[model samples]
Target: MRQLNKFTFNICPTVSIHNQINLLSNEDIKYTFNDFQKNKQIISCVDNFSEIERDECHIYFCPYESKEYHKITNNFPGGIFIHVHEIALFDEQPFEHKSFFQISQSFRFMKKLTLINDKRSRKLHDNNEHLSIIKYPHLSQLDLSEAQDDYIEQFLVDTKTCLPNSFYLCCRLSSTEKSDTTLCKKYNMNKLFKSAFVMFNCIFQGLSLFDRRFNQLRVLHVNSSWIRYSSRLTINNTENLPNLKCFSLYCDTDTVVYDELIVPLLHRMLDLEKLHLYLIIGYKNTFIDGNNLKRNIINHMPPLNIFTFNIRTTVHLHNLN
Candidate 1:
């Protein structure tokens, strides 16, 4: 197959000639060109290359340090999944020198990209143009953080295809809460995409998280520490998320958000099938309006297939009993 690069080469997930599809176990260990002398095994492992079966190689994984390796992987005829340290945007660095914007252009055939980064950066904001080139109908998953709303809005409106099926944002709650609300408020979630999965890990204030209707959203995941008081949390918009199937929420009681918020939010998700909550109970004494809350929730949302609840507690359950 090495000699068959002339034709479209496709590699399946099972083919192990080169462990290119699955990332190397030790790839997460930090290394540098200087450390190559002592880590020959690691160096040789990354240096090895083989002809990719273009048809089967829909997913590609690359290290954050290997700019040259990415140049080669980008040639694959299918989607590319590259490991990244973070969103790669550079001010003075040359475009050819490992910028996300440049890396994106390298794979014109790529339909989806799954970037793995431990942190978020403003570099994603700098790569707006390259991100727009994505063929929306083909792209399945996109995981990014600290991306600007202008770029996201443009993607929803300008694309010739539907938005991605699943989107993830991993970011610090404090940083985004102060800057993101205004930008996110300007866009209409219902009009953005027909059916989608959205996940966010960031702090939100006011109705930033609930004000907008998600008409086509099927799955939703949110991990935030603080909560604000807003009926938007309790208000249901069937026209926005008519088919919501699953919802997972993580919250702490030290904030204004509470079970009170959940009931109202539950009422809004008319078709919710599964519910997962991670609630942290603080020292504050509180009463459970369980009957009224559950009644409202059951009245609005769909029957559950499976329900899982995890509540952090310092007091005994018998106390509530």
Candidate 2:
């Protein structure tokens, strides 16, 4: 068997080349480039001019190391996954001294882009003048979970020209320390939600519920913190997300006041078929009527087939009907 015909390259550190090849043979493999130094052997083997083939390939890179993968992206044009940590890295020049935006522009055939950020990762700084200068027209799915508020804003501003069909944003609570709280206040969650809706209209179909524009969005996810500060921000209009089918929200803290934010948001997603919520109720003196809330949810979103909610110690799941 020809090597190019049988093997798929994976730039992950945890799995060996043999194991990756075996996994690739059994199922489609999504390569995550975490530590390139550790995978040098596999990289060298696949780097051979005869073995490398230009087929549909997916590449995932750590935000800071996207530069490292630029040299090899020519052979992979299917998609790119960027795990964003510090926004500054994207601004830095690497591999022939090209910025990430310039390097990304080389792959016009690329169709999907995934941006990921987690709580443990450092927050995105307020200054994003350097990032978000380019747009990928072929992307169909754009996921920006646990990203800094400024980063998302900059992305929306830059990519307003191109809208993906699926979009996701997950917000985690920052520490309540005075310094962090001050920074969080600068990036209000309410404004972020509002901007997301406005930008969604610019790229894809207009929001269906509002009859403002066509709705091409299908999947949406939001994970937020229940700190007292976020209580004021409500996802008041579900009509803005009429086409959404799968919706999930994980509330990090225990607070009933958050119900004010969640309930109204649920009411607006009338088209949702799947719903997941990690809620905190009755942790201390605060209390919420779970049964009544559930009934209200059912009444509003009649099309729901899968409903799951985790309320502190209790979990309720309603499977497909």
Candidate 3:
């Protein structure tokens, strides 16, 4: 114990004590929590609630299907940082699930929030009265990937709230459950696309880019399959993406590289420094006029430092002189 404590200080005395505690094993969790309990130090729980810190620690409760989950959370000190995953279970008579508003108002110092895989039973209600009271100025990241559409809309309605630089809103929806139009209208999808500055590795399935603008976008990645299927479809307001630096497109078919789609799209990204195009041509004798396409792409785009075009059997790389 003496050697371990001495080694900890030697590594970094100012390192967050919570991070150091997280390195312990399950058996060590119990012993460490017990030690913290004895010393009355701030105890933070991530994944399990082996120790109760009352009102003096951050707590992250992963999906736990115990009726005692709510009781454990209720005992946490007000204004404490808490992250709850999925739905909080309850087994009492007239069983009801906890709402996001309820969870948000329960703590005063909510620093970071992440909700994942919330079933329909515990879906957040839009009409919750406590929506106005929920505020977290210190929130560094928010992930609502598995939350319901209504819940996400309600949370984002308060535009005054400062969103973190890294925000994730990608959710998996069944094809039959919701149509593209319904989902787009419910979440104001176009507004979100324009506002985000750096979008990394996102799938835009069922989204329409007609007349939409990307004002602050720096990096954009989209699969060609995400584009709506229409003979007359065109991406409007491409000029609005003035800050786009890195653009990538994954084409499942060769037909998406026409002037209406790929050519015009690349022409709009005047500030792009990196461009990657992945084309998966089927098992048939096919070839793209690479020399012609290369000359055109170089003429339209800025002086790029890295450019990669990968087809099924051919690879083209260009570093401009």
Of candidate 3, the 10-residue stretch with the lowest lDDT total is 6-15
Highest-TM-score candidate: 3
Candidate 1 wrong stretches, greater than 4 Å:
1-105, 109-111, 115-137, 146-178, 193-202, 230-240, 282-293, 313-321
For model 2, the stretches where C-alpha displacement exceeds 4 angstroms are: 1-98, 114-133, 143-149, 159-216, 227-240, 283-290, 313-321
* Per-residue lDDT of model 2, residues 1-321, tens digit only: 444432344343333343345334212332332343344322221221222222222333222234223234222332333432122121111112123355355545444344333222232333445445465555433334433334444444333224433333333223333333233334333322322222111111111112222234455555444323233222223455667687766655554444444565567678989988776654333334566656768778889999887766322343212
lDDT of each: 0.44, 0.41, 0.43
For each candidate in turn, give its C-alpha RMSD to the true structure in angstroms.
Answer: 11.7, 13.2, 10.9
- Residues 1-321, candidate 3: write the lDDT tens digits: 644531111010122445455454434534554643243333343233333221123332222222222332333333333443322322111111333435555543444454443334232443445434455444433444444444354456544233344333333333222253344445444444332222212233312342343445566655544322343323343454577687777656434334444566677777778888776532223345676567658777766778888766333334222
| Model 3 lDDT, residue 272, Cα | 77
Residue runs of model 3 more than 4 Å from their true location after superposition? 1-114, 121-125, 128-130, 136-178, 182-207, 223-228, 231-240, 251-260, 281-286, 313-321
Report the C-alpha lDDT of model 1 over 190-255, residue by residue, as the tens digit: 555434334344444423456555555676677765655543233332333467788777776444
Q: What is the lDDT of candidate 3?
A: 0.43
Per-structure clash totals for the candidates: 12, 4, 3
Model 1, C-alpha of 160: deviation from truth (Å): 12
* TM-scores of the models, in the order given: 0.51, 0.46, 0.52
